[model samples]
Target: MSAVRAIEPISRGEFSKMLRRARPPPGWGKSIAVANSGGPDSTCLLYLLHEYFSSDGTPPGNQRNDSTSNSHQKANPRIVSLTVDHGLQSSSADMAARTARFAESLGVEHSTTKIPWGEGVFPPLPAPGAPFEETARRARYRTLFDEMTRLQANALAAGHHLDDQVETGLMRLRLGSSMLGASGMRYCRRWGMGNVIGGLDWAGVEGMRRWIVRPFLGVSKDRILATCEANRLEYVVDKTNFQPEVTLRNAVRHVVKYGKESAQNFPPKLLQDIETIDTALENLPNFDGNLNSGPERLRAFVQEMGREVEAIEKEVDEITHKGRLPSPIGTFLISKEALEGIKDKPLVQRALVLRILRYVSPNPWGSLRAQAKRRSARLEELARCLTTPMSALSKPFSMSSQVLWKPVLKRPKIVKGKSKGKVPAGWIASRQPPDLQNAWGVADRDITEPLLQALEARESEGDGGALDILFDCRFRIRIHLDAIPQAVIDALAAGITNLSIRCDKELYYPSVVLRTPKNELVLNPADNPTPKFPEGIAFAKPVDWVSIEFIRTLGNI
Candidate 1:
């Protein structure tokens, strides 16, 4: 290790220097887990933090008389340098070992977790390719998170940088991500990973004990590389990163860098423009109410975006049909349809889409172009060279064609809501008869429209999600349906006996299941589906609460 030097010096304003000075805010737990893969960014972080803390005892910024001439303020966490070995690489185990040694060299407490390492391993885990990358990343997190909890490490850290962020934003942009995806990574967020053992929600959740941290996001790739260079550190650059066909991040890592550099030319001006966009977003009065509406404005946005999303999907389908992967952006943008499909749970859906898209590589058959094409000609020549036997120990070679298998969506048209309707053509399960589909979105209008509108108004003000009540109708309303669970049927029938229908309108949508009086034995229509409980039964829909006297005969109890 040697003295540090800047790889790419920031022009002060271009970088978010505030992050350099920013400490974890109050209430955020403190012990840090730096995912020190021996990558330059992480190594830099380790070196800075180790030095930062060490120097603090001697003096503030000013050096004591015995301090070396060029020494800088050491920046360190109460650092635990952790490495995740996905074991997809032949050198992965060694990489972990080497990283551990390197972390020790930096005078930091280091640990390593070997993930997905087992017998029958080949060039990549599960015998190499795109699936291997996902296997590696997920395993890496699982191990890291597990370690975080086992060690009770309070904050989980990573070495993601500006270049990575820029690449991610570009990837999201290409994918036609909705507003949140376009928002880029937040500085911090609660980890979605949580656990409950035996249905008790306490400190028992596995990963919930540790908060994920990314201190380096506000920094640049150059700073990390500079730190690595200054420390004389060696990082193994996985050959797959340069292979475009393997991951969108690799492709955009190349493509997005240009934009980052171009922004450098007029850094101040571009930043000013970015700030202007922020100002506009900030000025918009209620985010969900105004711009993100259901009528003309939002409907138009959805309509226009609807075209783009459809076009992108068509492009992806055509490419796959032709036995190829779309460009990184193409794959990402095409995923918006999948995201839009789960509109109610937007964040969950976006995360799912992002996780799946990151595994695709642009190059389909990267290494074996000539061999697979000229197989007929090689047959005769190979007959003479039969003395040579092939071995799995063939110097870590991978043909990459194995990773090119296009993803097959076995179950399409995943309508997640209790029900949905008016979806785009080709979006839902086509097998579901069209007439049934037509009635899918048809709201039951007569259950009391004026009253329901009032309920909707109350909900608009952030009331509880829905209200359910069951009472007898004076108007002989013959509500017929069979999908309604027996318990609900009994409740509703009993309610009808002593009925006083006041707020009947609130019970019209998918949230309510009505049954005709004749089908009192069993009345459940297409409107609802309940989890099958072999014994105790379940609420297929809201529990119908009839007036007092009606309750006596509910469920014929």
Candidate 2:
């Protein structure tokens, strides 16, 4: 690791400027939620946001004629402090209380959400190299988003500073990330646009659009500490950060703090490159227009794209509707004309390919990037084949091992009593044959592969019913109680009795069934039992599937 150039301390004015740049439009509403963890960075962020959004800082246009009124009495955008208690440490509850007090001192509303780890509401720590931090972070943000929704806040803010950004970049580099990942964190991103560091699986949750704002991305950690000291703010330090062996982030932090200096200053260029890429993506062939084109032109462009995209969507839908591809999983077929049409338009080709790949991939975004890098040569070959004349492409070809194309002559249709002339031959895209396994091996290069394997192992061993599987860090599967072995249930009952468990009354469980070792049973209140065992527990699968929730949240994006 190379030492990063020290960043200058941030002043309140500079902070305000950063906020102005990242602030959402007025239409998103003025309510903001601050994720306060009672740590230095977050504590400072809470103070700064409170001051910035207070009545004293209200715009002149909204001021009243009454000069004698108290500044606090004036109306301003509502600011709320949200603290999530992960219950990982003994001092977590105390920290939550302290954070609430601090928010009250600043006249900000505060709330705390507790994650019951022992109650099986939260997933267990992941296996090595499976992004444990990313999973925890997603769960934390999920809690925050729920709170924001309940509070009717349009935006949520966090305290991620320059040092954090540097660490993130280094981690992404180590992970063999694409240019997007190497570019590091953005000052502003959509509420759930999962980036390289943060796995995209959990980001597409509903009601998460353009709701997260990080105003301190440009400020250094030292500067944040200095601001806290200048204001005499109290903050709790997490001791885990000092233990470099515990996590990669801590190791990176130590290196950045003490490593020898290097001439390269990568962050500025990285950010610029990311901005340029974003501009290019926004101005794709279907979205060609100047930035200065007013909102009306932008709206018109969006509508036009919407119509065009829908046509493509309908075409894909029709392929499935025709019963040519019956199964939802595995290989599917597309018309040769459709493939040629996509080949003629570069952007459409990329979009259509990405869409098809995403349909079968567990980690769609990661898979897309990996396929692009690993199969670049094959992709180019396929593109050339598609553009060539049909007579020249008579031989079977493949886009990649995963996407195979074979030419087959289409039978000519008879018009009345005579044959209508030969119809152009179409192509079929399907999975490569088993003998060609080397051509398209299963995409096992993903970080989530090991985790998926572990889940499958558990399922095979019949332990899956007792434990919920966190699939791809995106979905959770809770098997029905009946599927669990009796011995497992007996053991669980014994443990619960030993622990003297006290369940939260307000906590909702979709399905709960308990049986004692003595053949006694205690079922959830909602259960409807059978006659054989009058007190036996009945099970009904819940309608709220985790995968469905993910799809609903991210929508069509």
Candidate 3:
């Protein structure tokens, strides 16, 4: 048996390197929030971030040779420590309080938000040792992002480390996930976008430009604990993690830490024995290159798969760029020629369909409606329909709360004075009319006030500022921040009620009405050709539209 390699405390330089590798967006570090749970991982991360960003006296032997080494020398980033209490246990609040004290000691502002676990708000609290990890996680992040909106942060930093990544990968593998899922967590991603766990209610945070970053994803758990000890940092331990039966992730973590064949039944006897002796042996430390050998291989595999997925995603982006165009009135124009060009590439077709469906869906990606649309067979069928001729798909199809109507054939319109006819516009994707029953009980969705409030916040800052918000997860509502019209303000201020009506089947949102305080009908932007400032608001450039409660509630009626 080989001797075990010593796990050394993570050096300051190493920490800085990990953060750089995360590739945070331009405005990320200026104002950041940390999702601290009072655990060792988060506690250590908080201390490291405070030290890394602060201009205080630098610890000896922490100098870096990189050009950006001097960047942190006198840096003072706004670091807010945020903690979410799931309220699953009685001590959850106390744990959050302790985290606040720790953050205060480091001179960092702290905020703790509690999740109200009850009927309609969240699923009923799980029974003892029952499967509630995913629910708790989703609700925790949901609350975190809500607080972030209130604080107006540019980024969120999490404490997910390499060990956590490995556990995630293993759990996904056990669940028979694809390479993309088994690749585990990303270092940085846009908040409330993609098929991420906490992407629920994305419209609320759309255009916020907020990112969730994991700087510790490359660091190991052993090294993290060592760093805490070296820095004399204190953190609480959650006993729930030790019970492998509670969750698949916890079970995988046990197998990774202690070999699966441990006398204590490390993975628990009742759980399926998914890990083989070969994989378990690889995790054991009694081998040459003990610390780096097996885990490094797994990390390399994940990284390689991540690179492949990134390339595929880039390709999808390129394909969509040529194929998809947003119409002036909230609908998307799909070029028939572009779809035919990629008809042979089934993978790209499915991906493209997924992207478009996600964009046009009235509900967020994490919602039940959106989840139902994620079926592989449905995507494949949609891809086929999209590539087929306009006459083939005569009937409109509905999925993900959006309707894909019959394609508009390319034809030359009446020309006058040497002017060219209307160009070849293909299929139109619009929001699905509300059923107001079954899963979705709410019929009317009015977000005029919240939308106005968001615009007002941006308007107060300065001129030359523009804000784009997603309305009903379907329409991209762009407003000139500097030129918020008084009429628009009056509409919201007077408690205006807005709703979309199917005035014309051929037109995208033919008529959208806004009722004023005196029950007056405001003109629909889609119907108006030469609208004034308030109605002219739709003329601005488009931006991302994903949201939470307010926008989630703003469904098509």
**Candidate topping TM-score:** 3
lDDT digits (tens) for residues 1-557 of candidate 1: 99876366332233223233233333334456778777676776666656555444343444566555545634334668899877667787887887898778877788887664543321235665445655566556666776777676666667776556655543454444444343455444434322222211112223223456565655567766765676577776667776543565664454333332333333454344433433443343423322122123333332343344444445434423432323321122122234234345433333332222222211111112212221323322321121122222212112221112122222335466443322221111001111122223323333434334434565568653333332221011223222224554355445541112221121111223333444311122333332221233223323323111111100000
lDDT at position 358, candidate 2: 39
Better of 1 and 2 by lDDT: 2
Pairs that collide, model 2: 204-554, 205-553, 206-553
Per-residue CA lDDT of model 2 for 336-383, tens digit only, reads: 566665555643444444444433323323344424443434445555
- Model 3, span 1-557: residue lDDT tens: 99989889887778767777665556455578899999999999899888877855344566654576566655556889999988889899899999999999999999988786764445677788676777788778777877877887777889998888876766665544445455678888666433422344342435335678898887788889999999899899999888776666666566555545432454444345445323432453422322123566655655666676666567777766776765645456777777777878776676566666655565654343543344656666777777775553356776544555446645555567463534445677766665443232323345466656666676576444545544444444444544545665665666554422212233323223355444434344432432222232233222122211222211110
- The lDDT ranking, best first, is 3, 2, 1
Better candidate number, 1 or 3, judged by TM-score? 3
Runs of candidate 1 with Cα error greater than 4 angstroms are 1-30, 57-77, 116-125, 194-209, 258-557
TM-score of each: 0.41, 0.47, 0.68
lDDT of each: 0.41, 0.53, 0.62
